[model samples]
Structures are given as structure tokens and as C-alpha cells.
Target chain A: MKKVAIFGLPLAFFLLAAVFLMRGLYSNPAERDSTLIGQPLPPFQLVDVMDEAIQYRNDALTGEVNLINVWGTWCQTCAVELPFLTQLKDQGVNVVGLYHELDSDPAFGVKSVDVIRTEITEMLKTLGNPYRFNMLDEGRRYSLDLGVTGAPETFLIDKSGKVRLHHIGDLNQRVWQSKFARLYSELESE
Target chain B: MNFRSFLIILFGIILYSVSHSASSVEEKFSFEDESKRALFIELGNELRCPKCQNQNIADSNAVVAKDITAKVYELVKDGKSKDEIISYMKLRYGDFVHYEPPITPLTLWLWLLPLIFILFGCVFMFLLSKKKQVDISQEQLQKADEWLDTK
Candidate 1:
């Protein structure tokens, strides 16, 4: 009884630690949720150029080749990637732009929300309208669901709402020519 | 062994204990920069490690916080800027890595609240201890009255 009293808590704690170690070893990031890829794209209601409504967020764009590009007007890298995104838009691909909170612009120094209006207006003025539709995420309500860390993340969502490719930084021509097109065709068949 | 020899042995033991304690803090993590090292150790003593709740990094047996503290020592040795080191730590381990509970306006209350509570507690106990019951038995009261008049 005395031995049990001394050893019980330590033994249980050891078991808990072992469980966590096993989980970390076996868990893979790719096996995460991909519901947004193949299903109806989520609603992203944002104000566009000339104060027009942009319906970039909807359930309709799912089960097709769609690119959800994460950007903010404040981020230098995102601005640099704008010309490349414009080219992808010209290719008749459904390139959807998800504006990060605080506009990702260096000037929109909110340190918090990089919302849609700032991103759309700023980019439209400089880079021209590369996106067929744009959504305003003023509060970044949906970004948390998208698993964003650093900005300029691009997720290639297939027709089934399954994410086929998740790129961290820029979406350059070399990336689209090699990886993006192949993934696009793969999703088309599915 | 004379009395002087015995005194010398006792003095040696005292010296050894002092050096041992200092060296333990040193051997764990040592830096060339004396001022930053002193600040790190002083800060380590005051700020409780979030990973090891009961103890600060200086006091903890935690491997993660210990590695971080050791890295802080190394950076201080290398003359890396303090702000850069702090931000690097924040990026790698999140804000919880900093033990010094940052001096924000909202957090001023965390440090102030407990200190105020302790001061009040001490004062209340002191005032309670000073309370004395009056000796109000008839003979005592008469004696006290007589003594007061005599004085």
C-alpha cells in the first residue's frame, strides 16, 4: 500500500508522456482536414474596386481547380508575387485571392487584422484585378480554419474540396508550370 | 590538531559551500559578458519558467527552458543584440518562452496585486497582534484607576 501511494502518480504521468511522444512520432501534417477543397467554397463577401461586391467566397467553386492565394497588401513578398498571380489569372484558372488581415501591407500596420478591403483596393490599383473574385476577411475569421502562419500561402484546392497542394511562399511560373498544372489536371479528372 | 587547526578547517568548509553554490549557477550556463550574465541570472531568479511552473529557469530541471537559458548565455557571450535574441526566442517558442512577464500596462497589475495583498495581510496581522483586552475585573479596574492617579 505504501509503495502504491509513492509510485501511482509518477506511473500515470509516465504513461501520459509516452502517449504524447507516440502521437508526435506518428502524426503527419498532410492527413489534416481538406473539406474546403472538394466542397462548395466557403463564403467570402468583400468590397471590390469601385465599391462593387465580390463573391469570391461560395460553395460553388469546390470540386474544380481553384487556387486560394493568401496575401496582404502590406507584405513585400506578396506584392512581388502579384505579377505572377496576374499571369495565372489570365490563364482562365479560378484564382481566388484571400486577403490577409491588416492587408499584409507594410503601411497597414494593424499588427492584427489585415482585412480584405485594403488588400483588394491596394492591389487593384497597382497590379490590376488578377482575381476573378475577392473576399474581405476583416476579422480573419476564416483564416484560422485555413491554417495560415506566414502570409503568401497558396492552397490548390481540387474539385472535391481536397487540398492537393499547399505552397508556403510565392507561386512563380516555374511552380505553376511544373506542380500547379499537374495538380490542376489531376483534380479535373476527379 | 590544535584549536587553530580546527578553526582553519571550519573556515575552509564555509568557503567551499559559498564557491559551490556560485559555481553551480555558472556550470549550468556561463557567459563572458558579466553585466548581461548578471542580468540574465537575476531575471532568471525573479521570472518563473512557464514550462516549470514552480521554479524559474535558473531553479528548474526542465530541459527545454534550460536549453533556452543556455542559448541566452551563448548569445550574450557572442554579443548578439538583446531585442533580436528576445524576438528569436518568441518566434521559436512563442511568447510563453519569456519568463520575465513583460512589463505591459495590463500586466503591471499582476505584480502589484500580490504585493499589495501581502502588505495588507502583514499590516492586518500587526494591528490584530497589537490589540490588548482590558483587564476589567473590579479589583484590577480599581487598581488601574489608583495607579493612573498616582502617576
Candidate 2:
């Protein structure tokens, strides 16, 4: 009995470890949910990229269901996801774009905010604007406030201004159909 | 140690110092208050970079880490207390952003399991060593010899 107790403990520990490892292997690293879910959206006031005179505040997400997408011209995945975002817009999903920092005009090799915004505007024009308006994230302070780690992420804000979901990759039909579509419907009816 | 081994250790020390000095040369935030600057540095060290999971925000060059360090500096300058800044970070980036995770019901076992396992191991080893070196009685030894002879 003593011998059994001695060896069994270690065996059980190894089994538990194996189970955890197997679960880790099967899970998607990107699917890890953000802790900000169920919390209110972080406060920020950023300028609209197209019109510097206009500012989009954090309150814009209140009283409505909206999808806030983080994107940048340099991110290739964001370009691929643009079409899906447009489709979501067509389906009547309110989409707001948050432009991640471009800091300097890459083409001109100078630190001109206007030139950088113009380049982003041109890029969006060439592709298509799914968002109501793309807000410029200067110095990425707004992104930091939102705990955004990188571009090509999206947040779902519900009617009451609470952040419902934070998806950490390019949004697509598969993601929408599998998760966000049902989630949106549930939140919309609330 | 041999001369070659001594030379290798010296070389390693030089390499480490060079890397350490390189990081020190990176631009640091300046503050009007020395204590605020110190607090900013402390906060940076305490916070982990969400993008580069293992690297502290102070040492990481990742964009996210840079942004976090900047925020920490700003908050310190704003006269936010250490606890408030930590809570603010926890709210935005979750428990993973800070080095110290709160002991919640879900995480209580995580915090306690190592100590529990160490206690169990110590007890097991103590019992094992005791059993191995236990003194045998003369009568028991005689009985064992007689039993062996009969076998």
C-alpha cells in the first residue's frame, strides 16, 4: 500500500501534465480571449483620418453595437481582411476602423502626420472603406489604452458600451459565422 | 580552473557587460521629480510585455512594450499611485500584463500547489530515509535467521 502510494502520486502527476499538454496542442493560441471582455471600452478621443477637424470619441461606441477594427497599411493580413469587413458592413454590422500608428511617412522618409494620413487615405480608397470613418491613432496611445497588442485585431462593443469580445487576428467569414454572428445576435437582443 | 576556462569566463563576462551597457544607452524618460522617475522605472520592470510574453516592458524593444513604458511614465507623472497604475494596466491588458497575479479562487491552487508538493516530497523523503536506516531488534533478527534456516 505504501509502495503503491509512493509511485501512484508521480504517475498521476505525469498523467495530469500529459492531459494539459494535449489540450495545449489542440487549442489555437490566437483564440485566447482578452480579459477586457465584459468591461467598458477604454476612453479615448482620436481624430478622423479623412477630416482632422472631426474627432471620434469613446462615446461613439455607446448606445449602439459596433465592431472596432485595428488596422494598418503595413499589415498584409489587414488588407486581406478588408473585404470581409466590407461584407460585414453590407450585412448591417456597424464597423469602425482604428488606424494603428504610421508615425512617419514611409514613402517620403519624413515625419509628417499629414503625409502619412494621406497615404492611408489613398490605401483605403484603393481597397474600400468598410468603416464609417477610420480614426487616426497618433503615437498608438489610443491603441495602448485599448490594450491592443498589434494590428488586425477587432473588438465588439455592445449597446451599453461594454466590450463584448476582443478577436486578435484578421476577421473573416469563418470567424463571423462560427462566433461573432451568434454573439452579435445575442448581444443585439439584450 | 585551466587558463583556457578562465579566459572563456572572462570573455563571457565582457559579452554580458557589453549587452547590458547597450540596453542602458537606450533613451530613458526624464522627469522633473526624481522619485517619479524612479517609480516609472520600477513600474516598467514590474510590467510584462503582452506581445513578448517573457520580456519585461523595461527591457523589451517590441512596439507594444514601448507603448506600455510610455504609458507607465505618463501615469507616474500624473501622480497616480503604484497600485492604481497596476490596477489600470490589469484592467486594460488583463492579469498577464503584471508580474504579480492576484490570488483569486481560480488561481488559489496555482499559488498553493508548489508548497503543498514540496511538503509532500519532504515527508516522503523523511519516511523513506527512516525506513532505510531503521534499527532492527535482536529478537527480530534471530527470528529472521531461524526462519531463513527453516526455508
Candidate 3:
């Protein structure tokens, strides 16, 4: 009984720790809160990908519900989400694409900024251009301010310029039909 | 050379190579003021990269970390105070971006768990030693009894 008591305490502690560890494994880190959600878009500006003359600022998204998608040509998932974005655009959903410049790594398959833009244009032509105007986040200053950890993240902004939702990962029809479309319509009514 | 001597030399070579490579690749950032430069370095060390999760912004090779390091440099240049800079990151990225998270009801467990574990460990060790001492004393008592019986 004494031996059992001596070892049992540590055994119980180990079992408790194991339970917590198992619970942690089930909790997805991606489901974490965006501190920027419900807050106004941070002051940022991005130049147009196609036209250097055009610039997009936080004010540009004001007075309209806009879906700001942070995307890059290098991200495989972004390419997959492109068609869905185009479909949303056809349905008159205000979708703005922020072209985050990936590093000039051969592994990413693109080399220069010019090539990236050319490829984006080509992709748009082939996949169908959904973006109202693609904004070039050249230095990723805007992306950093927007708290984008990776490419293919989407932020749904309300008419008041507040970010309604921030989603990380590829957005497809099911995502649109399930959460985003309903939320967008709710904001439109407001 | 002995196996032990070879292992020591191998460790030395690895350490020297790592330090040499680190020094060669380290990116240098220029700040207007000396204090601002210090602050920039401090911020880099303090801020955790959201993407890398493990590495600080200064050491992380991830794209997000690079942007954050640049942003920190920019903020320092703009004459924003350290608190303001931290607040800026916390506002966007939440508490995960800062190495030192604020004390709140939600984070109480995270802060107190370590202290609780230490206390438990101390008590466990104390009880373990006491039990060992009691066992030794019991053995000593048995030996004395046998000695007396034999006598």
C-alpha cells in the first residue's frame, strides 16, 4: 500500500499530463483568434500589380463590403482558390486581391517581380480575373500590418471598414456557401 | 586519437562552423539613433514569429518574420516607443506575437502552472527522502533487535 501510494502520485500526474497532451493535439492552432477582427483596417497602401499608376489604400475599401484576399503566385493553394474567387466576382462580390511577393527562390518556381506579374496576368486570363484590381504588396508592409502569416488568407471587411472575419487557408464553394456568403449578406443589409 | 578526444574535436569543429556561418549570414540593419538600434535588436529578440512559432523574428527565415523584422526597424525609425511597437504587434497578431504575454484571467493557468509544478516536485522529493530515511531507520532498528537477541 505504501509502495503504491509513493508511485501512484507520480503515475496520476503523468496520466493527467497525458490527458492534457491528448486534448492539446485535438485543438487546432489555426482556429486562433485574429486580434484585428472587428477592428478598422490598419493604415496601409498597395500599388496596382498591372498598373503602377493605380494605388489602393484602406480608404478604398470604405463604404463597401470587400473580401480582401492575400495571395501569391508561389502558393499552390492560392491557385486552387482562384477559380472560386472568380466565380464570386461574377456574382458581383467585391473581391480585392493583394499580391504578396514571395522570395525569389527557384523552389517556388518564380524568379523576378516582372515574371510574377506576367504569370499572374496569365493565370487571370486562363482562370478568369476575379479581382476588382490586384494590389501589389511589394515589400509586404501592408501584409505585415494586416497580420498575414501566410499566403491565401482572406479578410472580410464590412462597409464601415471593420474586418468582419479573417480566414487562413484556401476558400472554396463550401466555405462561401456555409459561412462567408451568409456573413457578407448580413453585412450588406447592415 | 581516443574515441573521447575525437568526439570533443568533432564538437569543436561543428560549433566553430555554426558560429562562422551565423556571423557571415546575419543581416545588419542601420538605425538613426544608437538607442533605437538597441531597441530594434531587443524587439527582434522579444517578438515571436507567428509562422515559425519557435524562432524569434531576428532568427526566423520565414517570410512573415522577415516582414515583421522590417516593420520593427521601420517603427524604431519612426520614433515609436517600445510599448507602442509591442502594442501594435499585439493588436494585430494577438498575445502570440509577444514573448511576454499580459497577465489576465485567461492566462492565469499558463503563468501559474510552472510554479504549481515546482511546488509539487519539491513536496514529492521531500516525501521521497523522508521515506528513504524512515526505511534506513527501520533497518537499523531491526539490526539492533537482532544484535540484542543474539546477546
Per-candidate TM vs. native? 0.40, 0.79, 0.73
**Can you write out model 1's per-residue Cα lDDT over B1-151, one digit (the tens) per residue?**
9999999999999999999999986676766668877767665664445345457667776433455565666666777766777665554344455665677798898899899989977997877666543335679888989999999
**Model 3 per-residue lDDT tens digits across residues B1-151:** 9999999999999999999877754445765589998999899999999987788998898888877887888889899999999999987788999999789998899979999999988998999899887777777989999999999
**Which candidate has the highest DockQ of all?**
3
* Candidate 2 Cα outliers beyond 4 Å, as residue runs: A1-7, A28-32, A105-111, B1-28, B122-138, B141-151
TM-score-sorted candidate list, best first = 2, 3, 1
* 1 or 3, greater by TM-score: 3
* Total colliding residue pairs, candidate 2: 0
Task: List per-prediction Cα lDDT, in the order shown.
Answer: 0.64, 0.84, 0.86
Better of 2 and 3 by DockQ: 3
Best of the candidates, TM-score: 2
lDDT of 3 by residue, A1-190 (tens): 9899779988998999999899999986666578888899988767898788888887999999999999977788998998989898888899998888775543234577677778888888887778988888877777877889989899999999999898888889988888688889999999
Lowest summed lDDT across 10 adjacent residues in model 2 chain B is found at B21-30
Tens digits of per-residue lDDT, candidate 1, A90-188, equal 877788777665533243344433344554576677875677665555545455445444467788877766566767677788877876888687676
- CAPRI-style quality class for the chain A–B interface of candidate 2: medium
Clashes of 1: 28
**Could you give the DockQ of candidate 1?**
0.02
